[model samples]
Target chain A: MPSPRYTRDIPARYRLDAARCSACGHVALPRRTICSGCRSQDMEPVRLTRRGTVVTSTVIHVPPDEFTTEAPYAMAIIETPEGARLMAQVVDCQAEEVVPGMELSLEFRRIRREGHGGILCYGHKGVPVRRHEA
Target chain B: MRDVAIVGAGMTRFGELWDASLRDLFVEAALAGLGSAGADRVDSIYVGNMAAGQFVGQEHLGPLMADHLGMHGVPAVRIESACASGGAALRMGFLDIASGQSDLVLVAGVEKMTDGADVTNVLATASDQETEVYHGITFPGLYAMIARLRMERGTTTEEDLHWIAVKNHRHGAMNPKAQFRREISVDDVARSTMVAEPLRMLHCSPVSDGAAAVLLAPLDQARRYTDRPVRIAGSGMATSTIALADRPDPADLDVVRLSAERAYAMAGMSPERVQLAEVHDCFTVAEVCCLEALHLANGSEASQAARTGYSALGGRVPVNTSGGLKSKGHPVGATGVAQVIELFDQLRGEAGERQVPDAHVGLAQNMGGSGASSVVHILERV
Candidate 1:
């Protein structure tokens, strides 16, 4: 990964930082200057909760080049409690077991190595919330 | 605004052509289109290409292609909208003629995807790189997520999705330009390797190398180029959120619906008047969603169209008569231009075996990544 690109997103990747639209109360993950809902520029920075719910998921058998070793992993669109949706890989559970409406706790992790000996990219991964914890 | 017409349409055989370079494909298709229109020169050229730098380590395609085609010194530009690049280029050409800026225009779309680049990674660039690709989500994985949502909603089944592949392959068998001409049964789709869960290999459009081109002129002067010209009655394009997760409803392709609506309104007709169609069926589920969004099928009709043979040739409303992206080959950028070529052939009564009976009106819908961008056009036989 390029250092500039990797370092620029550290706040969001490390802390789940997001921007809330002051006009519409819509939250944008990874932060944005403009709100998609109401097109407001009056945005406030906010950190989203580490927990979210799986809206949809797929078990990828044929992975991309950067993730060849991570084949058969579960990737999904997870909706945070603030209603901001973002994509993440669901781990620490069977790939096939990840389903919609399942509760998940996002954890900071190393997503992938950009290339052989390249910079290691970091992001959030979802772990299923156990029934006992509920 | 003046109306535009497609005076000529041509394309290369869509498949892995190891012999053809990117420039070779573009020039060949452009010359073919020119020949079909009985002309050798165009006032301007629009090249639609995605990821030329990534695929072939080349850029500045507009001047490069114009010079290669022996039409140097003419105004030329490249347009990119991911997979909808071709359609977007066509739209530009149409507007050029409609707005009376240029008399004759050439629109071409080409992609050489089998050039040893990381095809999966190259395609993933169409999605939100920071939010989606960084998490290792492939295009199939994104669509598979939608397929899961549709299945969970009881709107479609795995069998229903497989039937889309079967129907397209059957149609493709009749198209000599198609990559996969052999028809397969639902069992074949079921047995194919799963790229993403619930989406098999057969369900995904293959990475291909091909090019397609079309000649556009004002409708009044169309007869001078060709006696049987297909009028571009309507052209529409719309865009939405780049990431699939950003959609309010993951299962609904609102971009398709919005673009189709704009095209239908411009054409002064409804979906009911369309006798044939070529939609962006990059994935099987995409076709299902498109059918409903285009209003060709309503409610459950979209899911059942393949199983009931309603979307097959000789049926009520035949779709993808040119085999579509599924079997016809999806070279990404070339797909949208090829769809218009299919409509041109069908409207001009040039489509051989897969021709729709008395097909007077046709529609083509091309899309970018995960419904972020969509371009729709309606053609009428004149």
Candidate 2:
């Protein structure tokens, strides 16, 4: 997997962000150019939390190419504390061990290699939050 | 805008067509529609396709299709909205006809995905590839999360999801053009290899290659071509955040609801009046979400409907009577238009054994990526 790296400065990354309405208290992802809820242009950027819980998950046995090597890997939609949700891989755990409501923390991991090391795309991956030993 | 009607419909047998190229699939379906309509000419053409550049390493579908279909120099445009491309194309066709700018128009959708290419990488183009696919979130994994959340909400069960697959497969067995013509039991879905945790192989639609086409004309002129013209009563479309995590309600699809509302308002009908529908069942849970979004049933009632056979043939409201994406196949661009074809047959009472009795009003809801985009159309038998 390509290592997880934030491409916020890059134009091609399609970074995940939200638009907070100044009037109607509405929030939207992708940092809308104008708030659809209140039609307010006074929106601001809010970086999503790096932690969340598994709302649901799936394992693809017959996987896709960038994901073929990780066939049967666990993937889930993690709802962050900021109320934003994104589909991501749930690693560092068995496929069966993952379940809804399991707390997860975002981590960097290799997703894929592009064009014989031309570009290495990286992003967030989730891992079950291991409880600290007493 | 003036009303539009589907003057004709056509599609190729959906499955793995190893012998056919993208152009072949497209030309075949377009020609079939032209032949069905008996129209010697078209004012404009619209083609719905998701990823021709990725699937077949080709793009610029408009000119290519127009040339191959022997309609070169005609105004041709391609619409892309992920899986809802076909529905979007149909809407564009509707606008062209409704505006009185065109008398006869052709709208076709085609996708050739069986070239044995790396589909995973290709499909990843649909989502936030960097944020989502980077961690290995396949399409199945994305939907599995929805299923798991639905389960946690006590709105549905694994068995309910299984029933959807089983029913669709049963219906697919009767569809001559279906990719998977064999029926599968609920056990098959439960026991099948897990693609995404709760979602199994059978619970998902196959990567298919096919084409579907339809001829659209003004409602007043529709009768000149075919006595069985299906009048398009209403059309609605909505778009949401491209990323699923951005949606406020993971279980709710406001886009479908909003689109349905707009369509129902235009059609002068309500969900309660729809007798049958062809919904985007790209995944089992998608059907459930569609049912809710359409307000055909309350939230989560889709699973109950599936389990009790209410969504099957001869049920409360037949859904996916054409086998849905699960059984019929999801050739991306072709799926939405194919759903309309099924409704066209049903409205004309020509759906054979799968026909819903006294089916006068029908609806087709086609969606793209994680409920981010949707188009709904209401069709009535004239």
Candidate 3:
């Protein structure tokens, strides 16, 4: 089989970082090389808030190759404290526990392991930041 | 530029076509399209395919498809833009006609996904291999992340996403060309096995084997082929960064927006003016995000509208009337042109029970690889 392509750096060790347009107030996540809205190259590297909230999510039973072992994992589109919106896996929760507006925090975890003898990959995953964690 | 119109459209039943070969599927669709157009000869051929080399260990699909269709020695070109390959091929064929380069052209897309290969790995090839896939993100995982972010932004809801799958599947049940031709309820979608978090088995399109083709020619020439011709009023295509994380907002698909903007501008219409649409619903969340990007509904209002049947066949501005990629079956390369075929049938009033009454104007939005590429086309009755 052909090697898999890791297209996005977000959620991975790269954990999408970006800067917003100060003039237009458009948030730029994953560190835009050039703002598509304002074309502003004058950007800053801003770390995204570790904490976020689940705005929407899905449970994928049928997964692609490297992710086969992790079927039925909760994936969500989360918004961070800095108003940064990204897609990440929701960890430390059952599939049914994922819901809209659920607060979460970012963490580095194993995303997928390659072929039988291949390498195991790591990335940023989102876990619910709840009051019961005490 | 001359006005290009779709004179003929053809599509095979989409599903696990184990008995069919890639070339066989392409030829079947191409021959049907040619027969419908009553054309004895094709001036040129264009094929849209995502990863034939990876999926079937076959490359050079352009000439291969041409030869298989018996249009040997013609100018055969292959178009690739991940999942948008079919739409991209249609654009190329459209240009050929509008430019007066060809009077009769064959635009086709096909993929043998269930060819007994490790399709999962093949599909991963559409992503940014070095960054996203290497980091262990599958397409579903990528979209799941997007759904999560959309939730945080209050852009959409899980129920909204589920409605997309359920509605498309409902429409798909009426489509003989669809792969999974069974109706599914929102509960069925919600209860399906999970592939990635928040995305259930029923929320995603199946890996299918199928083919679709459209015959394009000058509007004046189209009349000689068919009395009820569907005119290609406008087409728009755009690209984004390969990496999902490279995008500014994981929840938003600006490429689809840009393409829709250009297409709508060229067609002199707005989202409300479109009576029907066939969008790439590879995943349920994709449908929600795409609806927002196309301006079919406000991002925040998408979930509610979905629940209310605003995007259903009998509702205002019907969406995925042919079940979309979700139920229609996604053969990757064949996905785009299949959308066009659905639009053609709807515009011609040939869409039987699933048809939207008086669907005069329609649109098709096809995406490639997690929204990295998108192609939008607006068509109307001539």
Candidate 4:
């Protein structure tokens, strides 16, 4: 991964910022040139709500090189209230227990280190909101 | 536009292949295709490789393969659409002939995945680096999410997923060149190690290294190469947002539906007209999902279709007779061309043990990066 390209995506990953199509109210996370809902190019930045629900979840036993140490972790496609879905790891819970419809709160966390000499990458992970209350 | 036909098809045995380098595997398959066609040379070549740079530290495969295959000066190019590289290359080759641009074109797909690199990280290059991959998800984890969603909907059962593996392995056992050429039981699949929840090791395709090749020519001139040529009746391709989240539904696989619709329309045929199919079953769930999208199955309840033997060898529509990617060994870039080879064998009455009876029309659907890209080709006996 090139440093400049990696650096450019920092804000989107770190803060869950998205591009909302002005014409159609379609929110595209991490930004987009075309709106998926209406195919409009006019867009503006919008910060996503931290709250969401896991529509589906999986326990990753085999992971990428940087995430090898975190094998067997739970990952999910959590959809926010704004209708934007994103892939994130579900933290602080058993992998099997993470299920559809589970509430989540996105939090910033370390994702990985590129390679031996690469920079450390960080992104948002879904922490089950219900788990804390229980 | 002129009609195009595949005059010859060939592939290497699907496996780890410790002895063959990337270039060697490609040349071997290309030579076999040329030999099968009984032609001394081709006018041009297209090489399909997902990541030669990442997998083998070699890029510019088009010239490398063209040079290795002794076709030094002709137009050669590389095409990539992640896992769909092979199919996408074939699509371009089809267009090359259909548009009267080039008559003799050889398309080859190859991937050398066992090069001691981190397989998971290398495969992750296909995913959305800014959103999905950035959050630390592998292909298995991604597909597993698709499977988990289906399981929750009551449309698919765990048993349905297991049967796909069992069925493909049985088909693979009869194939001499398959990677895992042995049948496995439902219990075996159930007891296998879990890579992701609801998806065991058996449910997944192996990290394989192999190559497959196909030769294309104008349909009118196909007789010059072989008496039994497989006609490229139709071709369709579509792309979705790279981020899986951008799609309407993660479970729908809309791009697959769109591509299949286009191919079927271009062929002027319906799903019922297809006697056999070679689907991109990189995972068990993908087979069922794609079946629904292709309209081979009446509904999204593909679990019912699998359980009732709708996709069996002797059923309404035989699928994955080549053992699919699960058993056939998906070399990433080689899968599309390999699929066309299976269609060629079946249509020519050459597929011995796992042949679909009286097969005339066949469809091959190859997809890339979790439905980010999909290519569909419909073939028939010419």
Cα lDDT tens digits for candidate 1, B1-382: 9989999988999999999999999988999999999988999999999889899999999999999988899999999999999999999999999999999999999999998998988999999998999899999999999999999889999999999999999999999999999999999999999999899999999999999999999999999899998999999999989999999999999999999999999999999999999999999999999999999998688998988999999888899999999999998888999999999999888899998978899999999999999999999998
CAPRI docking class of candidate 1: high
Candidate 2's docking class is: medium
- Cα RMSD, each candidate: 1.0, 3.0, 4.4, 1.6
Rank list by TM-score:
1, 4, 2, 3
Per-residue lDDT of B1-382 in model 2, one digit per residue for the tens? Answer: 7779998888999999898999999988888888888887799999999999989889999999999988898999999999999999999999999999999999999999989777766776787755566566677767777788888889889998999999998888889989998988877788898777788888889989999999999988998889889999999999986666666666777889999999999998978999999999999999998899898888656778877878989789989999999989999999989999999989999888787888899999999988889999999998
Candidate 2's displacement at residue B276, Å, is: 0.8
Candidate 3 per-residue lDDT over residues B1-382, each given as its tens digit? 9999999988788999888899999989988998998887889999999988888889999889877777789999889998999999999999999999999999999999887788766777788675445444578777877777776677677788888888888899999998888988889888887677667778788889999999999999888999999999889999987767657666789999999999999888888889989998898888888888899988566666567888887787788988888888999999999999999998999999988888899999999998899999999987
Put the candidates in DockQ order, highest first.
Answer: 1, 4, 2, 3
TM-score, candidate 1, chain B alone: 0.99
The complex in candidate 4 yields a DockQ of 0.82
Tens-place lDDT digits, model 4, residues B1-382: 8999999988999999999999999989999999999987888898999998998899998889888987789889999999999999999999999999998999999999998877777888898877888777888878888889888988888899999999888888888879999989999999999988888899999999999999999999999999999999999999987877667788889999999999999999988899889999999999999999988886544666556777878888878988999998989999998999999999999999988888899999999998899999999996
Candidates in order have lDDT scores of 0.94, 0.84, 0.83, 0.89
TM-score of 3: 0.83
- Tell me how far candidate 4 lies from the true structure as C-alpha RMSD in angstroms: 1.6
